[model samples]
Target: MARVLVVDDDKNTLKFVRLHLEEEGYDVIEATDGRDALKKLKTLPCDIAVVDVMMPFMDGISLTKEIRNTYDIPIIILTAKDQIDDKAVGFEAGTDDYLTKPFETKELVFRIKALLRRYVDSESDNDPIRLGNILILHENYSIKIDTKTIKLPLKEFELLYLLAKNSQRVFSREQIIENVWDLDFEGDNRTVDVHIKRLRQRFSHLSVPFSIRTVRGVGYTLEMNQ
Candidate 1:
């Protein structure tokens, strides 16, 4: 079951939400205030959070900002404030979705389900993947470098996408083959090396020289921070 954290100051509201979410087969964790929510977050294994904007100890906006500093978990802000600016502020503070108070339980459950589906489908968008000055837009399948578009081949894009999806994580040739090439690659790790070399050569003219670093004994890592 998917785990969820529900942070609200009102005891009655928390109890109501917890029971409903539990009935839906979700593991629900509870917090009375934003400060307590942050503490719970440190130890709890929650996939998503339902946070109320008006809390006694720390308020949801501040708590959301603090969580965003390290964690990229999905956050849904529950608030009585229905103004556009309030919603804008929530989003600015890294809220994934916003729901107004006096909401129906069915609507709440539907929103949570939709957000979770989107979150699961696009988990890699949170990663930053840089190739030279070119930035791969993981959420959009496009590339932009120095305000210009970089056309990538279909095969090359998949190769780069998989590497970028796990930035700084080294993968052997056999692993890359199984993932990107769909081959039983039993020969050598040099296949990965060749692709890395070609990717680097293609983007070498930028301010940040594009390159993939090779571990002395391991495999290749896509390192744009170099």
Candidate 2:
């Protein structure tokens, strides 16, 4: 059973989340604020954390920064702020997923399951796969080059993994959507473009000898310069 730490000042919100998660068979731990949550986590082992962005002391963003620096577990940001900028800041602070306020219990459960499946229960095969100079650790969903290691979000990591595994092979937009986001994704097809753009920018900063390129009308591909 996976232990989850949920941090929120709102008692009603905490109760609601705990109820659903406990019903799903998760061992739930609750905290009233980020400071309290951080103290608990250091002594208690948890698989993941569901955090709220606004709180009395040490907001979610600050807590996320501290967690990223010290903990390996994934974090899901639960905030009422649904703006793109807020979401981006959360991601920048190392959150793996984000959920807005006023969300359904089923949706919350699904996101938790999705993240756990991606990062925790991943049954990735070990095959010493190298894309250019970077090493792909499938099991950890991390990439390494020299002494540096990078952890990416689930979608960006999956897209990079798929393209890197295939090398020069191009994946169509529809195929990518079906593979990464799955069929139930209600978002428009343009989301793939958004992810691809992010992947390109991140990879570029690393000075990797590879590029994620658009195939015009076809889709996209990872081209390695060797």
Candidate 3:
């Protein structure tokens, strides 16, 4: 059974969510606030976390950032506000998905299952990906090149992993966006370009044996230097 961490200040909300999740055969962990959530995370391993935006001690955004920094688990942010800006803030804070308050427990369950499916599929292979001298560690979300270890933000790391894993295969901008970001991503195709640029900039000085090449009018591919 998958373990889920549900963090919210409202006792009723926690009970409501925990009940539904437990019904779905998930091992549920409850935290009244962000600080308490972090404490629970330290002791118990959770596959995913559902965090509310409003909480004492640490807000959901701050808690999400902290979790992203330390754990590889997916996060879903819940809020009463349905504003696009609010969602942008949640995504920026490293949340994999977002849910507004007064949501149906069934919808939340679907989202949880979807996120779990994606994460489990991505990690189905436990071996680290290697391209020439570059090592992509999916376990810790870090990369090793030669003697250097570099940590990238979650999105950047995922982008690089997708490209490197399918090296030499050209992925259209649409495909890249759909795979790296969610299908509901509000950003434009330029988002892919921006991430590609950052990845190139990050490794430009390194002695790597691969390159991310843009196929004019098509998309991008990671090419091994020959």
Best by TM-score: 2
**lDDT (Cα, tens digit) per residue for candidate 1, span 1-226:** 7899999999999999999999999999999888898888899968888998888979989988777665656778887844545565665565656678877788788878876765556464445466666687645434787788664432345568787768789877677767754553222354456556656776677665345777777777777664
For residue 2, model 2's alpha carbon misses the true position, in angstroms, by 0.6
The clash count of every prediction, one per candidate, is 0, 0, 0
What is the RMSD, in Å, between candidate 3 and the native fold over all Cα?
4.1
**1-226, model 3: which lDDT tens digit per residue?**
8999999999999999999999999999999988999999999989999999889999999999899888888898898855545666776666777788789999899889987876766455646898888789877778999889987765678888888889889999999989887787655676677678768888998899999998999999999999
lDDT of 2 by residue, 3-23 (tens): 999999999999999999999
Candidate 3 achieves a global lDDT of: 0.85
Candidate 1: C-alpha lDDT = 0.71
Supply candidate 2's per-residue lDDT for 56.
90
Ranking the candidates on lDDT from highest down gives 3, 2, 1
Best by lDDT: 3
